[model samples]
Target: MSQKITWKDKLDFILFGWIINWAFPQYYRPKYHYTRYRKILLINVIPQKILGINRFVKWPVHFTSVIHSPEKITKGILCDPGDNPGIYIQANNGIIFGNNVGIGTGTKIISANHNKEEHSKHDTTSPIIIGNDVFIYANSVVLPGVKIGDNVVIGAGSIVTKDIPANSVAVGNPCKVIKHNPPHREKFTREEFNKNIPKQYHHYFDISSHE
Candidate 1:
C-alpha cells in the first residue's frame, strides 16, 4: 500500500523541480532576466534561512554564465550571491571558497585567461582558493590563479592580479596590501557588536527589537 501525497508534498516537489531547472544552463539561457524571478521564488519558499539563501539559490547568476564543472566550485556557509550586476565565474579549473565568504556586486573570479603569445589560445587554467571569513567588495575583479587567505578584506573597484596573504587589507588597481590584521567583528557576540555600533544607528536597532 502507498500513502497519498499531501499538498505540502506536492509543493516540495514543485520547488525541487524549479531548483533542478535553475541548475541546468539550457532552461535559463533563453530567459536570462527570469533568473531574478527564481531568486525571489526561493526567498519566498524558504524564509527562515534567508541570509544563507545563496548556498541553495545561487542567485544573481545568469544561466548563460559558464560553470564548466559544478563539482569544482566549493562554496561554504553564509555565502552571499553576487549583487545586482551579478558575478561572472569562469571555472575552467576550479575555485574553492571557505566559510562566510561574501562576494559583492559585479565581482568576477576568473580561473583562466588568454595566453599572451597566442591571443586566440587560453593560458593554463589555475585554481582560485579563498580562505574563511573573506569579504570581497563590489566591482572588484580577481584574476586567474589567485589565492586569498583567511580574514582578508578586498576593497571595492580593485583588480587582484596576484596572491593575497591572510589577515590583510588589500586595495588599488594592482591590489597591493595596505594594512595587516584588519579589524573584524565576526568574533564579537550580539551584545558586544551592538555595543560597538555607532550611536546614530542605535535607534534603528531599538525599533527592530520592538518589532
Candidate 2:
C-alpha cells in the first residue's frame, strides 16, 4: 500500500512546497510522477529559488548548468535538458532532443557558431538534432548542426562536428564512430528499469510513492 499523506506533509505543501511549485510552474503538472514532483520541490526549486541560481529558467535543471535561449530548445517527456551540473547548452539556433536522451556532466551542446567573416555575429544554420536513447557522456562538446541518430553513445571528452549514424558508439577529439551496435528496441519492465538506475537517484522514480 502507498504511504498516506500526513497532516505534516499537507502543512509542508501548504507553507513551502506550493510556493516553490507556483514559482517553478513546469513540474507542477499532473503528468510528473508524484515522487519526482516532491523531489523537484525539495531539491531543485526551493534551493535554486533561494540562491537565485537559474532563477530565469522554469524547469528542474541543476543550478550549476548554463543555458541560453531555453525557448529554442525542444524536449520530450522525462527529458531533463541541462539538468546535470556543469552542463552548458546554447540553443540560439535550436536543439531538438528525442525521448530518453542523456547529457552527461560538463557536456556542452551549442547550436550556433560564430560567423567567420564577422566574429561578433552568430551563424544560425540548423538545430542540433539528437535522437531517442542517445547518451553523450561527460566533458563532450557537440557543435552546431550535428544530427546524432538514435541509440548513439558518445564517449567522454569528445568533440562532435558531424552527423553520427544510428546505433553507433563514437569517441575522441573529433568524435567518430568506433563501433556499430544493434538497435535498442528491447523494452524493460519497471523492475528491470529500476535496476539500471543508481540507488542514490532511486527517489526520483519511486513507484511506491505514486498517489
Per-residue lDDT of candidate 1, residues 1-211 (tens digit): 2345456545543555455344421121112212343453454334312433333434333332223444567665434334334667766678887655778777888888888899887777668998766899988999888999878999998899999999899998999999996544443222422013334334423423222
Q: How many residue pairs collide in each prediction?
A: 0, 0
**Tens digit of per-residue lDDT, candidate 2, span 64-106:** 8888888888765345777788999999999988656788999
Pairs of colliding residues, candidate 2: none
Residue ranges of candidate 2 with Cα displaced over 4 Å: 1-39, 47-52, 185-211
**Weakest 10 consecutive residues of candidate 2 by summed lDDT:** 186-195
**TM-score, one value per model:** 0.58, 0.71
lDDT of 2 at 20: 55
Candidate of highest lDDT: 2
Among the numbered candidates, top TM-score falls to: 2
User: How well does candidate 2 score on lDDT at residue 120?
Assistant: 95
